[model samples]
Target: MALFGFIGAGNMGLPLMKAAAATFGKNEVIFTDASKERSQFVSDQTGIRFLTDNCSVVKQCKNLVLAVKPQFFPVVLNEIKDVVTKDQIVISIAAGIKIESIKSMLSNSVRIVRAMPNTPAMVLQGMSGICFSEDTFTDEEKEIIDRFFKSFGKYEVFDERLMNAVVCANGSSPAYVYMFIEALADSVVSYGIPRDKAYELAAQTVLGSAALVLETGEHPGKLKDQVCSPGGTTIAAVKALEEYGFRNAIMKATDACYKKCEELSNK
Candidate 1:
């Protein structure tokens, strides 16, 4: 039996399986997807066993990750609820799905951990927010969950009530960041730089800027001030961004994301 099993092989599932394969041997990881072709592809690429059905994955693995979409949770959980044992630990990556909801789907005695991880996890630089049900997981079980999350990137354990906020801050912010990079590259390309070179420069600048923030632990506003001197080009561009409502746009976008998460959780 594989040590870990993933019930979906889509975008989030693929990356998560890859992360788990890093900690457990590839052969120790098993997965199943609704699409046989998708499952086979992941199996071929990662050398992990691909079970033909979701129940097989649940039965064969001790640690099960419910990597299916939020909408499909009901169907998938119904399929495995009969076989899932109290001894197994189930981790869910479906956004907005709470621990209580999962417990209701299966059995209240089942150990459940909810996690929100972003697309950056594909590159092993993901930020994850994880929360576990009260009085359910032992210290060793919690350690196992932490190790699984950290295998891909950093994780913070917080109250599940803050999960919607985490979704806006990290889960959905990657798309906003990508849009910013695209706009930056487009602006440079308009100035006669090659498109590819513009993208490379823009992306690297964002990467280095983020690294600076993490490494120096300095306020981003102070860093901006460091680059902006009196009568400077950086300040001029900053003023233009302010006039264009750049900051307000980001604020509104994240707010929209948070609200959407709340709506889903309510459903």
Candidate 2:
């Protein structure tokens, strides 16, 4: 029997499955998807088993991951609800789906974990936020969950109520960071730098700056101050960004993302 069963084989699901295969034997990891071609492709590429039926996956695996889209959760849960045993733990990556909602769809006593993992998992640099249902896990079970998440990158356990904030802070913020990098690159290119070289420089600067923040454990504001010497060119560039409401724009974007998550959860 497979130890882990994933219900989708899309972008996020495929990366997660590949990561799991590193620790678990490829034969121990199985998955199913609506598209047979996609599932077959992943199975052939990774040497993991692919089942045709979702319920078959539930019957075979004790650890299940609901990697389907949020809108499909109801149908997927309904199909597997009858076969899901108390021994099985369901980990959900569907955005905006709450533990309580999942419990209501399945059995109240079912062990459920809701996780928010971003697209960075594709590159093994993901940040995941995890939360558990009222049904508690044993030490071994918790360890299994941690190992599965850490296969790709780091994770943190938090109250489910803060999941939306996590979504804004890490899950959705990567897009904003990408936009910043593109803008920076464009500005340099306008100054006669080659387009490709500008992009490389801007992207490397972002990567190195983020590394400095993590290594130094210093406040970002203080780090920014360090770069802005007395009447320096860096300070002038910073002033231009401030004049264009850069910080406020980011704050508003995150606020909007959080509100949209709330709206989706309510629906």
Q: Write the per-residue lDDT of candidate 2 for residues 132-198, one digit (tens) a residue.
A: 9888689999888999999998999999999988889888898998999899999888989999999
Q: On a 0 to 100 scale, what is the lDDT of residue 232 in model 1?
A: 94
Indicate the TM-score of model 2.
0.96
Q: Report how far off residue 91 is in candidate 2 (Å).
A: 0.5
Provide the overall lDDT of each model, using Cα atoms, as 2-decimal numbers.
0.89, 0.91
Q: Which stretches of candidate 2 lie over 4 Å from their true place?
A: none
Q: Model 1, which residues run further than 4 Å from truth?
A: none
Query: Between which residue pairs do clashes occur in model 1?
Result: none
* Candidate 1 TM-score over all chains jointly: 0.97
Give the per-residue lDDT of model 1 (tens digit) for 88-110.
Answer: 98989888888888989899989
CA shift of 235, model 2, Å:
1.1
Which structure among the candidates has the greatest lDDT? 2
